[model samples]
Target: MSGSPLSALSWRKSSLSGPRDVCCVEIAFTGAATAVRDSKNPDSDALFFDERVWNRFLLAAKTGEFGPN
Candidate 1:
């Protein structure tokens, strides 16, 4: 769950997100942490992984760790 930092923060979602907005992710930079959320349901709760963890996730993603055939 997120704290007050995410309350009034401005979020930035990937521009490549489809028009349907179903397959989308949103991230907010609050200096100390990064907030990730599902664009399909902005009001729903979000997950806050440490920035280091987030970077590791990104590295894995870039290397096709979650890729398909």
Candidate 2:
């Protein structure tokens, strides 16, 4: 699926995000792709990942592959 424009997609931060929205990242899941951008700098470019890679990253995150959950 083609992704909607970045400005048009709904961006959301994690519930675990730091207070005052600082040092946080926001994400938008666009049908076939996932987008990531700094909450402090939404206007900056975002990194895009395909569904497969995104899923793998999520799995690794849940499994503590990167570090303590």
Candidate 3:
């Protein structure tokens, strides 16, 4: 992720994001990995995750694995 030029990638904000939202993230899918970046800092470096790992994270999130206990 360090050597790649993320600026050239086409990024999209989540459907949950809104015009008035102050905290949001944007994502881009590469051939081998998914990249995520803070919407407030598009020019900054992004965090990259393997496709499988990203999918698992999404599933867990949907199932409330990250919810407060």
Candidate 4:
């Protein structure tokens, strides 16, 4: 969150993206925090979070803390 907004940041798509063009969240690891944005719109808005918070988020996602599909 320390850097400028998504309008100013450089965004890129993932190389491992799926054949169906699976919608993924683009990320910029700025060392102190992680910035995420919609893959479809590289120049759009993004959500930024502290590295610790981001790690916790990934853990919860992996553990299905958001409830079953």
Ranking of all predicted structures according to TM-score, beginning with the best and ending with the worst: 2, 3, 1, 4
lDDT leaderboard ranking: 3, 2, 1, 4
Alpha-carbon runs more than 4 Å astray in model 4:
1-16
Stretches off by above 4 angstroms in model 2 are 1-4
Q: Regarding TM-score, does 3 or 4 come out ahead? A: 3
Poorest 10 consecutive residues of model 3 by lDDT? Answer: 1-10
Q: Candidate 2 overall Cα lDDT vs. reference?
A: 0.87
- lDDT leader: 3
The estimated TM-scores of all candidates read 0.81, 0.84, 0.84, 0.66
RMSD of 4: 4.5
Residues 13-68 of candidate 2: C-alpha lDDT, one tens digit per residue: 99998788878999998888999999888877889999999999999998999997
1-69 in candidate 4: lDDT tens per residue?
Answer: 345465565665678787665677788777677899887666566788997899999999889999995
State each model's C-alpha RMSD to the native. 3.0, 4.3, 3.4, 4.5
Candidate 4, residue 22: CA error in Å?
3.5
lDDT of 3 at 13: 94
Residue range 1-69, candidate 1, lDDT tens digits = 345545577899888877888689999877777888888777777788788998999999889999872
Clashes of 1: 0
Better-scoring candidate (lDDT), 2 or 4? 2
